[model samples]
Target: MLAEQTIAPDHPVFAGHFPAHPVVPGALLLDWACHSLGAGQSAASREARFPRSCGPGSRLVLRAEPGKEPPSSARRFAITTEDAGTEVAVVTGTLGPLSTAAGT
Candidate 1:
């Protein structure tokens, strides 16, 4: 399954995150990812990774797949974007219960 988001170039977070050279906070990315993925329980286990920097106007593409090997209720996801013609992973982790319809 796939979900995507684009950070606004004028997003307010840029102001405090770094006035000179703004970079989207990893927390914000995680929040957006959880919401986009329809996470059912906020208390459930979750994690975020910063493999690369995300700036304003950057497009975040989320790809989700069923848990590997076991087919459990848990789902694996990754937020990535195009970098130098190659896809770069910005955040990767497992999500909690899904609140909405399942992903394909």
Candidate 2:
């Protein structure tokens, strides 16, 4: 699954999450990834890696693919800046469940 994410410039998360140098919280980023790639269903389990920081008002793309491991429930995914075309991922992990995600 794939998703286009545009973090709102005025998103409420900016209020307390580093008022001077705000960045999206890791937990919130995970939630966004889960909701977008999960196809609405929550994940049974997940493992993730955050290679970089993502700020508000950025255009991002979330991508997910089935993991190579057994059981077929495993998945691999990444979030990247839509325009950067860089070698880094703002966030990447074993997320994007098969159903609804949390905080929905």
Candidate 3:
């Protein structure tokens, strides 16, 4: 995976997501990570432990298990195959079990 693009904040998706807070939603961040890997072929799965809310300007961070598979989402995430390989973007943030996903 491209390490640089993984954490770059210039991504357009975050622009209108939350103007006031400017926080990178937990699901979004995780989805991006999944995208970095091959979406359909990705063996990644995420389980965020939302001990505390990630407020605005929280500086989104990408944490991965190296070669672990990406997580599954209820909503449809964007998964595409490029020259480089398959990429999974825009994971399902519509789920209401964030706290449970995070094991909070």
Candidate 4:
């Protein structure tokens, strides 16, 4: 399951973040990514790099990369789980200029 939301200029987070154009907070992005990854659903260790901020209605593609040896190479899966049903992820992360799904 993947999750994504665009931060509209009138969103609450933007209200406090800035009165003018709003920028998505890094923490929020991280949380969104984490949740999308379902790290808690499976109770697996997870990691995410929110390198970019998404604006209102921005499209985010969150993919779950499950396997061993980790995603190596420049373009690879940053997140990985040791077991399919262990509920314990071995590694997880993100890579890219804006942390897009195509980053790695």
Candidate 5:
């Protein structure tokens, strides 16, 4: 899966993170990756690494790639992002058991 997002300059988090030079928080980026990958139904266990700082108004492209394996209750996904050709962040982890109910 691929997703795109932009951190607006007026976003509230920037004010407290830094009044002078604002950057998007890593936690928020991780949350975005989870949502983009539709992992809400599963208990996702992941770690994120930020190699570059992303400031306000930066356009980010997120990509989620599945591991080379068949589907199962636990699944691995590699999530990464880039902004204007520069790599920004990467997250890798496994999703917990899949839900059988609808709309999970």
Candidate 6:
């Protein structure tokens, strides 16, 4: 599945991150990636690396893919932003099992 988020210039974090030139925080981006996977899901192990800064007004897309290992519930995801058809920031990570429903 693919999830998308738009970076708003008025986001509260930007105020303290920088007043003159605001940029999206890497942690915030990771949070978005996790949220995209599932609200209740947790990552057992993961890795994330940012190649470029994502400024306000940027549109990000997160794509989820199944892991290569067999019989594993883990999933891998990639978060990216594009500019003039070129990929910008890329956040990658893995997700743990989804939380089961009550009584299940």
lDDT of 3 by residue, 1-104 (tens): 23223334555656786666554566665556555544432323433334334333233333233322233332222221222243323222222134434544
lDDT winner: 1
TM-score of every prediction relative to native: 0.77, 0.77, 0.35, 0.46, 0.65, 0.76
Error of 3 at 74 (Å): 18
Residue 53 in candidate 2, Cα distance off native in Å: 0.5
Candidate 4 clashes between residue pairs 3 or more apart in a chain or in different chains? 6-56, 6-57, 7-56, 43-87, 44-89, 45-89, 76-104, 79-92
Cα lDDT tens digits, model 4, 17-78, are: 65575656656655555556544322222335533444544444444544443343112233
Candidate 2 lDDT, 1-104, residue by residue in tens = 38886899799999999899999888887777667654444463366777788787887777888778754656788888744555458877775344422322
Off by over 4 Å in 6: 39-41, 97-104
Instruction: Tell me the spans in candidate 2 whose CA falls farther than 4 Å from its real position.
Output: 39-41, 82-87, 96-104
Query: Candidate 6's residue-wise lDDT over 23-55, tens digit each?
Result: 888778777766666644454335556677778
Q: 1 or 4: which has the higher TM-score?
A: 1
**Ranking 3 against 5 by TM-score, winner:** 5
Off by over 4 Å in 1: 40-45, 69-71, 97-104
Regarding TM-score, does 1 or 3 come out ahead? 1
Task: Let me know the TM-score candidate 4 reaches against the reference structure.
Answer: 0.46
Ranking by lDDT: 1, 2, 6, 5, 4, 3
Question: In model 1, which residue pairs have backbone atoms overlapping below 3 Å?
Answer: none
Ranking by TM-score: 2, 1, 6, 5, 4, 3
